[model samples]
Target: MNNVDLELDLNNLKMIFEDLHFNNEIQPEQIPNLDLYMDQVITLFESNLFETKRSVEDKLLTKTMINNYTKDKLLMAAKKKKYTRDHVILMIIIYNLKQSLAINDIKNVLKPIVEKIENNEKVDIDSLYNKYLLIKTNNSEEIKASAEQKLKEVKDEDGDVLLYILSIIDMANGYRKIAEKLIDKFFENTNEK
Candidate 1:
């Protein structure tokens, strides 16, 4: 159930236990309610603990996977103390794209976009893809057309960057869903605070 419901249930249990203890004349039938309330509280606590543990485990796994994947692409060449959602999203996208493109090629293609993002400039995927194709390949027109088509196929949402990255990676590795799940868990944990 929700947090409010869980809190109300726990409070009710405490009140009932206190009342029962204060009045020893309470019947054995009344004891059943206390037992039931205690059981519900325990169950809720266990469920919450399990969810929390699972979320932490999922986050840790995602961190490790992304670290290995982006070891060569990190700007500082050092392990990050904290990774933003954008960073994880980018890593997921790059990991997926690496299936068809070499790591160095992918880095070259993404360097400009990453630089723009770091400078707080709006990134235009279509423009970046076109420029990358023009600079790196002989068939610029054909590559630009294909990349544009792929970019157009991606659905834009509130978190378009994350979705775009996940979609690209998923197209290549089918592990986008797991990354999405981890992202959701990450946000959920943040909201709990």
Candidate 2:
């Protein structure tokens, strides 16, 4: 790639990062304190997460997906057919994690939290979700910096885009592997008992 092309690409990349809008994440305060029905939950997610969809036709949350999640034990069953704030929070977490992790892996990672919610333990789920949002805010800058650094380091030779893409894939695969291994080491046995 020529210097002009590189500069343009970097500018485009920065623009994309700026568009991420960390505040776009669903806030704990935004969730209704009162319980919600399935259709309500679906509407809430669709309205809140419309931007996260890659396509207008994509469904963020569906009745079938929620039913399957409950059936698979990834989510707690609704009480009297109504879902709580905790359930909404968990579904958001699950939706994000599902993008990069296997369903079983997500279940393993979330099992303890699910148990706490289901058992009516004083888990302070709002605080936990806030912490996650804080971490997400922190990581966004780190990710942007890393991407900028990688772009600078990438050769200006032909196939620069391909090289950059491969680098990103390699990094993502590495993190996914580490996460899966950690889940295996710490959580694989949780399901045993």
Candidate 3:
């Protein structure tokens, strides 16, 4: 009963990728300021992020993963075995990034933001996360329109699934790469000041 009955094809993937937006990400302010234990953090992800899950086995997060993220410095250390809103926001970014990029890549990409936090600067995780969300959300419309236009451009009305699928992938990569470039540019501007 838990199995998904959806079929995969270019049209389907196009719609899927188009529908994939990060607006559902947990806002920092939504998390409580009080420190929460590991179990609480898992519960938070499970309940709040469950909508992002494609299946029951697709767990949003786990203790070992959290521990590993902390150990790897991809995440800040939990406070007395508890997590704060900052921790949650960072974890959210990690969760999303890990879907496509490798752990090392994710660590490197987020290093600047994490370092700013470590320096005790008034870095706004909320604003940062919001920016990421904005980038992803804003791209959704462009992705949808681009996919639709490209699909229409195909000579075969029945469609060549392989070609369409590859096009979708290219479009997806284009957006993610652009997001990375934007992030890099933001950090560069910050560094210059």
User: Best by lDDT, which number?
Assistant: 2
Instruction: Locate the minimum summed-lDDT window of 10 residues in model 2.
Output: 1-10
For model 1, how does the per-residue alpha-carbon lDDT over 1-193 read when each residue is reduced to its tens digit? 1212222223443454344322222122222222222233233334332333324343322344444545654221222354433443354346335445555555555565566676778766444434533444454344335434444554222234344445546654544455445545443322234
Q: Which prediction has the highest TM-score against the true structure? A: 2
lDDT over C-alpha atoms for residue 163 of model 1:
48
How many clashing pairs does model 2 include? 0
Instruction: Name model 1 segments beyond 4 Å from true.
Output: 1-65, 68-71, 74-80, 124-193
RMSD of 2: 2.9
For residues 65-175, could you state the per-residue lDDT of candidate 3 as single tens digits? 999998877888877888888888888889988877667667767777777777777878778777887887787677667777776664244446466667778877886
Evaluate residue 32 in candidate 2 and report its C-alpha lDDT on the 0 to 100 scale.
Answer: 97
- Error (Å) of candidate 1 at residue 173 is 16
Question: How do all models score by TM-score?
Answer: 0.28, 0.89, 0.75
Q: How close to the true structure is residue 101 of candidate 1, measured as C-alpha lDDT?
A: 55
The regions of model 2 sitting more than 4 angstroms off are: 1-8, 19-23, 156-159, 189-193
